[model samples]
Target: MFRVTRLAVPVLALIMAADPAVAQDPPLCAASSDTARTAAEVIAAVAEHQCPPGSRLRAAMTVAGQAVVLQRSGICAPESVRTMTIRPTPDTRALDTRALGFTCILATR
Candidate 1:
């Protein structure tokens, strides 16, 4: 059997609270150097978010070694959802809000 660690929830919750746009659900995690693989992995990670009750990938964008994804809810609301970054090590996988490192909540104009 497989289970999400008790740890992942809190990390994702912290990411969610970092942005009002992400408040409707917890963030998802996806990582890889390849964009296609990142999208595939991200689609798989959606369940981790417990999102929408019904949702699907509407679009994905890769920028600066990360994937910025959008999801369409069952209620038809579009969300700027999970942000996944490619890291060379698990030690670097932790999300932060700073301008200096790998962050799920990257600042965008």
Candidate 2:
């Protein structure tokens, strides 16, 4: 029984170490405000910094707690999707990005 238990422990350790999911690193991320003046620019900067060549944009959104304004004439209008403007709220003003309020995720193709 003692010898079996000793062998089982090593076998279990080897099985767990062979898992691809356990060996993989978490996704990379980057944020920049100094060079990224617009949403497009911010996404580009983050991709350049964190993603490898041939990567594509996966998701983009404003940072939490940042105030923003969405303007549109009417819901049914063809041009109703107007613009999204980021404004500095008291809580977000002190953030490292100064409330530019842009973040992006990228994935390898």
Candidate 3:
């Protein structure tokens, strides 16, 4: 018979968390913008940056007051999908790559 103790639960959790597969970083996203005003402009900012040709902006949403846009390129290998945030300025909006800094996200596929 096996008995599970309270301490064992946390230890097991820590061990599981340390697993490479689970702990690995997610896919990264990047984009940049010069000047933007409307949401459409913000979304387009990514395409202007480093997005592959024929890639399109799939979705745009505001989370916790932050605007995020997702870009996916069907033509690109690995079918990479990326997302970037559009920050509001006093005048127009801008996508700041420095803010994200190779930030990773779960595969959008």
Candidate 4:
């Protein structure tokens, strides 16, 4: 009886330890004042910084205290969507591209 009681206690704890509530809330990525700007706005902003076209821009943002990271969308010549991850940094602002493992280039096309 003593041995059975000890084992039962541990088994009960293991079963009760699992909580289903944690699965309800998942990490999310929402638009913020910074990301609130449109793709063209971000691209144009980066162009002012001399970023060349056909480049990639990665932005790490936080939403609801959760980090929502994404690459900027790119626009090709003739104004068509060629890429989904494209971010442009403004020329006037000194955004560090190295931290994102990518560099910001001007978009003339």
Candidate 5:
């Protein structure tokens, strides 16, 4: 009886550990919107502003049905491009205007 009890306990433990419903969700942001804004266009847009020389501008963009966070790093005058990286928050479900970097603009749909 003792041996039987130990064997049954192990079997019960194995059965309890077989749950398969736990799953993970996919990332909210995919590679689809990475190309929405080219580096050159961002630089040109910044240059058109009336800020001081060598100053930069922060622009917000809506992408792929979400409000993505955008940050402009530096100016690349020769290449007509500005280094910008987008940060998509977890709850960016709307296309409303939010502060992106230093400027607030509506994201593209």
Candidate 6:
């Protein structure tokens, strides 16, 4: 029984990690309607805002003349990064992330 329990623990952990449904949800942030003019401003605003315990900061912004569509997460971290996605044309949609688990704080500039 002892040997079986030890093996089961690792197997369960692996299963949980592999399955999105079984995996823990990413932390959620409070919704905000604040807008920032630049990416730097957005980063700074997110950094300054405090997240509740166990939650993290996230922001989505549209900058004028910025060609790439960027999605940024983990905004509260000191070294947050942005992932770029190239669309056929610039995405001019208002930043709305409620359906993506958390509502993004900052939207279009």
Q: How much is the lDDT of residue 44 in candidate 2?
A: 55
What are the lDDT figures for the candidates, one per model? 0.38, 0.39, 0.41, 0.37, 0.37, 0.41
Predicted candidate 4, C-alpha RMSD: 15.2
Give the winner by TM-score: 2
Alpha-carbon shift of residue 107 in model 4 (angstroms): 7.2
Which ten-residue region of model 6 has the weakest summed lDDT?
A: 96-105
Backbone clash pairs for candidate 6 read none
Model 1 agreement with the true structure over 1-109: per-residue lDDT tens digits: 8689999899988988898786563332332123233334444554454344333333233442433222322222334344443433444346421221222321121
In candidate 4, position 59 carries an lDDT of: 32
Model 2, span 1-109: residue lDDT tens? 3456768889988988999877754343444342325444444565467655222222223432221221111111222222234555666567734323332223333
The lDDT of model 4 is 0.37
Q: Please give the lDDT score at residue 44 for candidate 4.
A: 56
Q: What is the per-residue lDDT of model 3 for residues 1-109, given as tens digits with 9 covering 90 to 100?
A: 9999999999999999989877754323344332323345544554455554433333334341233223232222234444455455555334432222112222323
Model 4: per-residue Cα lDDT over 76-108, one tens digit each: 233322222234458514654311122232235
Worst 10 residues of 1 by lDDT: 100-109
Return the clash pairs for model 5, or none: 61-107, 62-107, 62-108
- The alpha-carbon deviation from the true structure for residue 19 of candidate 4, after best TM-score superposition, in angstroms, is 46
Better-scoring candidate (lDDT), 1 or 6: 6
The alpha-carbon deviation from the true structure for residue 34 of candidate 3, after best TM-score superposition, in angstroms, is 24
Query: Candidate 2: deviation at residue 97, Å?
Result: 14
lDDT by residue for model 5 over 1-109, one digit each (tens)?
3456657888977776675444332222211233234435454554454234333234443342222223333332233223344555555535433332222222222
- Supply candidate 2's per-residue lDDT for 63: 37
